[model samples]
Target: MIKEAIYHRPKDNFAYAYDKETLHIRLRSKKGDLTKVSLIYGDPYEWNDEGWKNSKKTMTLEGTDELFDIWFVEVKPKYKRMRYGFEIKSNENFLIYGEDGFIEKDPKNAHFYFCFPFLNENDVFNAPAWVKDTIWYQIFPERFANGNPLLNPKNTIPWGSTEPQFDTFFGGDLEGIINNIGHLTELGVNGIYLTPIFKAKSNHKYDTIDYMEIDPQFGDKKTFKKLIEVCHENNIRVMLDAVFNHSGFYFEPFQHVLEYQEKSKYRDWFHLRDIKVKALPEANYDTFAFTHLMPKLNTENEELKKYLLEVGKYWVEEFDIDGWRLDVANEVDHQFWRDFRKTVKSVKPDAYILGEVWHDSMPWLQGDQFDAVMNYPFTQAVVEYIAKDEINSEVFKHKLIKLLSNYPKNVNEYNFNLLGSHDTPRILTLCQDNKDKLKLLFLLQFSFIGSPCIYYGDEIGLTGEGDPSCRKCMVWDKDAQDTDLFTFLKKLIDLRKRYSAFGANGQFEVIESAKETNHIMYSKKTVEEQIIITINNSNSALKVHLPFDISKNESMNLWDNKPQKISEIEIEPLSFSIIKL
Candidate 1:
């Protein structure tokens, strides 16, 4: 046995409370190293003259990645607290793995086992329950629609009149969003994630000049309120972007600092080197990504923290917005976010607080900070395999298994999964304009766990490169739109909503991943039903075999609504099938 490869911990992903009563424990061993594993656990205080009184539960092989095999088991402790250890076995070797180290046999003392001291109800990570069922559509306000062209900014070009530039605007406003609520409803998304909408000089609005006021270009507070009303009426929740990390150059306090230097009262609000604070010839003050125009805020300042926390509370208290997507959230101090969560939840207990974090965000997702982070790891894995073709099916499965094992199942359900965003190339463009590949991408995204988000106009085949370009005007012309692609996505969304097994309620399992055929098969299963999906990423047709015998059981092909009994299924090139049993 490779003792060094065995690993476990009593907190975070390895072991955590899935809910108030249940604890999910996991153990990782070198891939294919262990033949069997089981959990030996009991309340720490429960003991007898013979030894510590405990029960053993066999652990199921959850999944295997490139280097590790994950074992999982769920237990509801009789006393809500327990000490646990693993009994691992290879062909002829046996070992007891615990908090201390490898042992020849189970120790009679509970101190030798890993301890989940207590399962406190307050410690359980609780994101809003509504998030599990939501399908999010992300909208860049300036590019979506122009319902009232009268509100257009000076020099605003005609919608979709020319290629997008950094400073260009097409006059998309909240009124436009209200006018096009049908588009979202028709697309089957239940949530809309709008980019930053507070008053700012730029079209993108990430550089906030004022946190409290809505940008006039997107309409006044009344129009925004109406937009919220309309969205809520249509059963679509709204999530606005919050840019608290930095302020635009034209932000009043920033401008005051630029003018008065050392004398400005807001001097402490920002990070400054010398009092001069010149933007030209390289800025002496800290900024977001060294951009001279966007000055990073000192969130540690009490006054500034209060102001930001109020901004968080105001939207939910006043407008009844469903959520807040924090931009550059990882850059801010953790205390500020904790306070922000407290403030926001004070007004509305279930308001979703999503953070923009591109990497592992376990620190911020402990139920105290962010409810969830933008799932970029999920995005990267999908893009690498489906869009870029940089990885085969086997490697893709490995990456996804690794991602799923990183967070608690509850956190994974609310994770904001997106394919393309304002920061990356459009999905269709990334797929090299291959609609087939794009369909496969959508199939995996909507079927996998998490609250999936669709980049505006991606369903209708809007294509572009990175930022400025990715932020293109929403294509409204039905004749020109890719209706076929839109219909494909709509069906996937419908499946996600109509069946529990096809959505977040099910457990994901990798059935098979064939590198030679470049095809993969996976299943989403619940106690009542199971959904099997097969995707062929290769150009040639492929036949995928089911692992178990299903000849006697009745099965239906969810795509075409036809009954099928074959254990082997053939999938066309760049296509997929959804089978329900």
Candidate 2:
């Protein structure tokens, strides 16, 4: 046994309450070091004259990263408290491992083992239940559709006339979204995430001029209200973007600072180093990424805090919005987000609060701030293995295990997973316009554990580079669009909803395949069925052999529902199939 390789903590990711009654525990050991591990647990006070009363359950090998093999088990204690330890078995000998270190035999003293003082309901990480089961559709609203071109700004070009530029507008508005609810309904996604729709100076709407009003190009309050009513009537939930990290240069408070310099009452709202300064290059105030046009706000100021908190509450209370996707959330202080979560949930208790964080997000996901983050790590890993061919199947599996282990199980269920967004190149472009590779990427994404999102027009084979190019106007002409890609997306969405193992809250296990190094296989298990999803990312067809005997097990291919055998399987190059066993 590699004694130094064994690791576990009393709290955090290693051990935590999954819910009011269930506690999840995990252990890390050197890869393939221990042959088996059994959990010995019981109530802290459940003891007799002989010794502490306890029960033992074997732990299963969950998965492996680069250096460690994770072992996990869930226990429901008769009482709400627990004292537990591990019994590790190796080829040579068996040893007892506990808080007190290695021992020759099981200790009669319960104090020698790890302890969870209590399982309080208040400490449970409670995210919105609906979020786990939802498939989201993200819209870059200005380029989604054009219901009324009369509302277009001056110099508006024809719809999809040319590649999108930073200043070009395609005249998309709330009325346009209202006109296309059928498209969303038919696509089978239940949630819509529209990027910044508030009053703003730029076509993208991230530079907010007014936090309370809808941009004139999009529509007025009444038109937005009608849009929301219609969306809800069709059983679709709407989530708006909140850009509280900074405001547009022409915003009233910032304009007051510009006019009055040091004497303005709103001077404290911004971080200014000098009183006399102008323009982006010369401005002495802190801004968003050195762009003086979008000045960063001092959320610590009491008056500024009140204004922003009201902005958070107003949409939920007035518009009946279902959720808020915060912009530049990591740059803001944690206290402000805590208050934002409280304010939004006060209006609608089940409202989802997602943050725009691209890195490790443990700080903001403790049940008091953001429910989940953008999950960019998931995106990068997929691109590296499937699109760029920069990493092999083993490396991809290792990266995914590390990513999934970074959060609690509940947070993983609600994570906002996406392949491409307005900020990145389209999926087809990332795959070098390879249709088979794109299909494989979608299969892996929808089958993984998280809430998945699709960028608008990505379903219809939209392809472009990053930023402005990725924000092209939606293709409304059915004849001009790629019907094959559209049908593929619709069928993928239907399959995700039809399978119980694909449920957000179900069991997932990655099975390592030694026969095919370029292939990845994982299983999704529910109470009624077990499914094996295999993908071949290489150029040559790969042969896959099962690790277990399924000679008598009933099996079928999930993609086309064709019968499959349990013997060695063959996967075509850059293609995937799901087998129900």
Candidate 3:
């Protein structure tokens, strides 16, 4: 008798929506030790009166035979009833492999995959509850552009940039962002998420000096109002960064504590006594300081709550900004988010809120405070899958499939996907300045399951790394950078926008997937349209068997510049290809 296998999703001992396009399969052999195994599909099975068939040949586990304890699979079936199973024969079934709740097993007779019809093929799931399924583009104020130099930081006053002037200002402001509204619209981004523009001692403004006012260096109340008016006029929404998690030590209200120590009446706005710091910093019964200069606000303080809430309300009612993106939100009290959601939603029901958390934020996504979370999991998953060669294509596809299934059904509707962002290394660099690989990742990010965002410079193929390396001043000299990357991003962004089926609000299903040494192939379908995305990750020319049904319509290839109507097409080595029908 073939041994049976039990699949587990991340939360516990269960995997749902097997019909969804992706899945992670694992095998723990019944023997003493088996580090590896093979998963075979398309084999026919019959028992009693029932039988099933696989559409294609088997995809073998290639790269990660030992280290990876999980098998990621991307499934694109004709209907929900796809029959599949594994052939777990490693070291005569010696070792077993299953982690993160996935059960190890010996292959049983082929199992039936009861596909869920309601499952969407394009799910842009946002993990954090505070955010909505809206489009978002992260902008760095100084490097984005120069609005009014007078509003820019003054160099004469104080010491800055402990780590290579990253903390210093290069003069970009609100006017700079407002100046380029047309640029944003052309790029197809509907919402703009700006880094801190509030009154702060540093350029990054993570150390905010005043919670209520705009930085004199970032323009005044009127400049912001004008920018908001213009953005809304163009149907471009604005989401400001609220650094409430921490404030600059120099803030006037907080200054009382810094100057007067325990005697200050405003001292209770921090959590000093709660967390131990060195001698110079005061005890933050009311607030918490992440570092000496940045003091964390004590949401427990009623007085502090009133002040922050009032300021939060003022921006929505008076200035009419869309919402806030809380920085380092994980460390902030959950009660604060609870109050924030109540207060902010009272002002603007559809107002979008986001949190800057970097891990599995399931606790926060339960619909209390945030509408969405910054999806680092998607970014890191794809990156590590491809770049690190940590997981094989089939295994990677399994991870991809489980990501959508493991979360709430609606979360698939609003995930914020990105190839690169302000804080991480650029995608172009990760691809080693290779345009083909970058193009493939770009298509996957946009087409997969999220409202994909092109980090300001990433679309233009700006190659940089680390904190300040990725954050370079936008080259006004458009001709000075990588134009091929720019054009591809533009077209890809438009493709997602034109087809609702491809955007954040649509359904997603991985159609066909194959992972080999040098190449990979996967296709996704939406109700209104279907697209086949392919990538050749190797340096040498590689051929991959596309396991998708191209018979629905005349498939058109967009990767070759002009759309080519063809029965079949091959993706060039080191290139990414997309087909829309």
Candidate 4:
């Protein structure tokens, strides 16, 4: 046995309450070191005539990465408490592992085993159930439409007339969205994640001037209220962006601090390196990415925290908004988010709290903070494999499997998955306008775990580079838009809704093919149905042999809703097929 290679922690992802009644435990051992492992667990308080009453359960090998094999098991202690230890067996050695150290035999004392004191229901991570079922549509308010042209800003230009810049506006507003709710409904999206709409200086609205009022460029308070009403009536949930991380340069308190310097009453509201605030050559205080216009807020300030907490509670309580997508969430203090969750969930218990965290987010997802973070790691891997072709099928699978193993299974279900957003290049441009590659990427995204999102113009095949280019006006003209791509997306969305296996929480399996390296096969299965999706990213047609027999079961093609009788299948070049069994 490789005693030093074995590792187990009593908290976090290693051992966590998967739900209210089930405790999930994970053990890591050196890859290829152990063939069989078993978990011996029982209520710590249970005592029998011999010693402590216990039960032994075999742990299944959940997954293996480059260096470790992860073993997992879910147990429900009768008394809602447990003391567990591992019994690891290799080809030539058998050893018992406990909290203290490895021993040749099982410990005589139960108290020495790893312990889960109690299964507290409140500690189990709980997100809004509706979130995982949602297909999110992200909209940049200024670029989506120009329904009420009269409300256009003074600098507003003709819609889609020019390539967008940092300061230009095309007058997309709440009224425009209200007029276009039918478009969203037809697209089959159930959730709308609008970029920051609170009063702000720029078109994107990430730099907030005021949190209580809607941006005049977007619309007034009453207009937004009507937009929410129409969205709910159409069964679409609305989530607004919260920019609590920083305030704009002209924000009241921030402006006051700039004028008075050391003597300002609100001096402590921001992190100032010097008493004199300067923005000409460089900023002397902390700001968002050194842009002096966006002054970072002191979230630790008690007064500021209370005010922001009210901001969180107000939107949900007043407008009945479904959730808040926090901006620059990682830079803020953890305690603020914990209180933010409490305040918002108090009024709307099922309200979703999604953070804009681009990296490892295990710290904020422990039930006390945000429900989920943006899954950028997933986005990076997909973009590299599908668009750049930087990694082959085998490498892609390994990277994806390793990423999925980082979090608990339940958290994976609610992760906010996206292909391209306001921050990245459009999907079409990323794939160099190859429609076949784009289709393959979409098939992979919709069939993968986590809630998926469509950036505003992506479904219509809009192509652009990064930053301002990615934030283009929505193409409403039928002749100019890619109608065929739009129709394909709608059909795929409909099928996703119809198939239980296509939804979040379905079991995922990667199937390896003996015939080709450019081919990839995966299946999503539920108790009611199973779906097998096969893809050919190469440019040549290939014959894909099934690893198992499927001739006995009735099979249908999910793309065209056509039935197919088969033993093995032929896949066209640069395309994918979804088979429902």
Candidate 5:
């Protein structure tokens, strides 16, 4: 017969109970253990400080090993939650407890931090409906400009270097961003997603060293306040890039973990495998797995989960930022996100959560984690079909149509549609600066669906490919750009804001058009308006008869206000159109 060992109860910790809910309680041993674990919980007022002594009797399950992965118990009263942990007793096992003699966290053993109730038939929706058709612009600080010469970090080690790389920091700050809101407004962008601006060791600032403060390299808190002030004034919302998955080696959170490893108060915030002692490792500490400088956060630790939730809440509540673009969201534990979402939203009801997922985000959108992802797959698909010589119009149309069909209705509306961004080549280079091709990509980009995004200089025709090249500073000189291209982008953006259909509630259809192949057309329609798009594939002008039943629906030219239309329209070689029907 197994006897129950000494234990403590948790408060409001039970996440679920049903006709017969099964509890999977996790625990660690501080003393002896060979087998068996039991759960105890109820009203502390009924059982008082003497609660554990008379804790309710539930079915006690048996198990070996020092930890309990599953221990089933019964809850007779629905909606009645109580505190609970576990106790273990055997020839060899340990029982971990808190200073209050309840359940203390053990840095040596991993624990699940994010928690949720089991799915029930009841409505489980958490997030709110957000405004669709948002227009976003990405700004790379140093590369963006020097609105203020005095605030420039240009002479600093990283910024002063002649070599243009991650180490180089240009002197862009909140002031620069605030100074540019009107510029963005004129460009017709509604939201601004700034790259990492938090205190960090790198100019790129992806590896955050501080979560609480704006990086001094960028500006101070007052500057950030001013940026927020100005952006909101112009009706442009801001989304901060939250890179909590990892931190720079010098990050204070990591430093605390290093100082005490498995023993530090902050030890539960990180992972430490086989260690020589409780102090910092003599050799440099481990990276997430050898990434070297970026230390992976251990979100699985319960103590750490509570800590991160607080950090995430602080930003939303304190700064009034619109939302967070969670970096590397896929690599982090899913539970961390579920809990993180719950906590952040609790502080701010309309807080938007966007995950950094390069692929399809169907999993995250299943009524839990994020509102949407960065839309990388869609960006690649759109770029390949329209810009690359290899992907034909037919193939591109199919991919585009299929992507729209797969995402949730609202998810598609809120998807971040970016073309040229800081990470990839400017769309100008991506399309080889081919005017016709660039126009086609732009038309589809602005009209097809989702929240449209513009790289800082994409509207002005800046050209470069990848990394250091893509990060070139924006050009304000009006005389120095491809004038025709600049005018074309401005025109499309103006049209984009004019159409309610751009919000993604419009009807859609596939017409015949061709790039590498022939016969491909993509179009959208709504009660208020209709848009027809066509791309001619061949090098020479081609006439495509309307498909068996397809006919031109527009009475007048949409984009150019061009007149003279016949039933059968001839498409210029490699040309496209946005005809209003």
Candidate 6:
């Protein structure tokens, strides 16, 4: 046995409370090193004269990555606490692994076992239930539409007349969003995540001049309230973006600091390297990524923290917004976010708090700071496999399995999954304008776990390379839109809403990944039903065989709504099939 490769811990993803009564335990071993593994667990206080009485339950091999095999098992401790150890076996060796490390035989002592002292319900990681079911549509306010051209800013250009520039504006406002409520409803989207809309000098509004007021280009508070009312009437939730990490150079306090330097009362509000602050010839003060215009806020300051906390509560307490997507959340202090959560939840207990983190965010997702983070790792994996063609099906499966293992199941459900946003190249552009490849990408995204988002024009075949180009005016001409792609996305959303097994309620497992054929098959299973999805990423047709006998059981092809009994299914190039049994 490879003793050095075996590992486990009693907290976080290794072992955690799945709910009030269940505990999930996992073990890691060198790939293909162990033939079998089982958990030997019991309440620490339940020991009698029989040398620490315990029960053994087998752990199933969850998945195998490049170097390790993850084993998992769920247990319900009779006393709500557990002392556990693992019994590992290979063809030539057997051993007991525990808190003290490997041993030749069972120690029969509770001290040698790993301990989970108790399971506290309040400590469980709980995000809002509504988030898991939501299908989010992200809107960049300045580019979506112009319902009331009267609110247009000075020098606002005609919508879609030219390619977007960094400083250009098309006068999209909240009234435009209210006018197009039918667009979201017809597409079956239940949530809309709007980019930063607070008063700012720029069209994107990430640099906040004021947090308490809506930008005039997006209308006043009354118009925003009406937009909220309309969205609620149509059963669509709204999440607004907030940029608390920095302030625009034109912001009053920032301007004051530039004018008065160290003498300003707001001098401590920002991270100024020297008493003499300057924005030209390289800023002496700290900023967001060295940008002269955006000065990073000192969130540790008590006065500034109080102001931001109020901003967090005001939206929920006054306008009744459904959620807040924190921009540059990873850059903020942990204590500030903790206080932010308490303040926001004080007014609305179930309000979703999503963070913008591009990497592993286990530190902020412990049921304290963020409900979830923007799942950029997922975006990268999908882009690499489908858009860049840099990885085969087998490598893609491995990457996904490893990602799934990094968090608890509940956290995975609330992850904000997006293909392309205002930050990256559009999905269609990334797929090289191949609608077939894009279709396959959407199939995997909507079927996989998490709350998926659709960028403003992604469903209608919008294509652009990156930042300023990705943020373009919304294409409203129905005759020019890709109607076929729109229909495909609408069907996927409808099926997600209609079926439980095809959504977040099911467990995901890899059925097969064929590198030679560039094909993959996976299943989402629940107690009552199972959904199997097959995809062919190559240019040639291929036949994928089911692992088990399906000749006797009745099955239906969910995509076409037709009954099929074939044990082997033929899939077309750059396409997929959803089968329900």
Candidate 3's C-alpha runs over 4 A off are: 1-135, 156-164, 274-290, 387-391, 511-515, 548-552, 559-567
lDDT of 2 by residue, 23-141 (tens): 98888899989999999899989889979988899998888889998888899988889999999988886988889888878887798899998999877788888887788999988
Candidate 6, superposed: residue stretches over 4 Å from native: none
Give per-residue CA lDDT, model 4, range 3-117, as digits (tens): 8899998868888998888998889999899999999899898887788777889998877766888898988889889999999999999988889878887765688789999
TM-score of 2: 0.95
Q: Mind giving the per-residue lDDT tens digits that candidate 6 earns over 1-581?
A: 88999989787888999899999999999999999999999988876777888999999999987788999999999989999999999999999999999898888898999999999998889899998899999999999999999999999999999999999989999999999989999999999999999999999999999999999999999999999999999999999999889989988999998888878999989999987998999998888998999999999999999999999999999999999999999999999999999999999999999999999999999888999999999999988998889999989988898899888888898899999999999999999999999998898889889999999999999999898999989899999899999999999999898888777777899999978998889998889989999989999998988876777888889999998798689999898889997
- Assess the local accuracy of residue 294 in candidate 1 as a C-alpha lDDT between 0 and 100: 94
C-alpha lDDT score of every prediction, in listed order: 0.93, 0.88, 0.63, 0.87, 0.64, 0.92
166-201 in candidate 5: lDDT tens per residue?
Answer: 566667667767776777887777788888888887
Q: What TM-score, to 2 decimals, does candidate 4 have?
A: 0.97
Give model 6's clash tally: 0
lDDT-based ranking: 1, 6, 2, 4, 5, 3
What overall lDDT, based on C-alpha atoms, would model 1 receive against the true structure? 0.93
In terms of lDDT, model 3 sits at 0.63
Judging by lDDT against the true structure, name the best candidate: 1
lDDT of 1 by residue, 1-581 (tens): 89999999788899999999999999999999999999999999988998899899999999999999999999999989999999999998999999999899988789999999999999999999999999999999999999899989999999999989999999999999999999999989899999999999999999999999999999999999999999999999999999889988999998999889899999999999995889998999999998999999999999988888989999899999999999999999999999999999999999999999999999999999999999999999999998999999999999999999989888898898899899999999999999999999999999998889999999999999998899999999999899999999999999999998888888999999988988889999999999999999999988878776788888899999998798888888898889998
The CA lDDT at 337 in model 3 is: 85
For model 1, what is the alpha-carbon lDDT of residue 248? 88
Q: Residue-pair clashes per candidate, as listed?
A: 0, 0, 52, 0, 22, 0
Q: What TM-score would each prediction reach against the true structure?
A: 0.99, 0.95, 0.74, 0.97, 0.73, 0.99
Give candidates' CA RMSD values in order. 1.0, 2.0, 8.7, 1.7, 16.5, 0.9
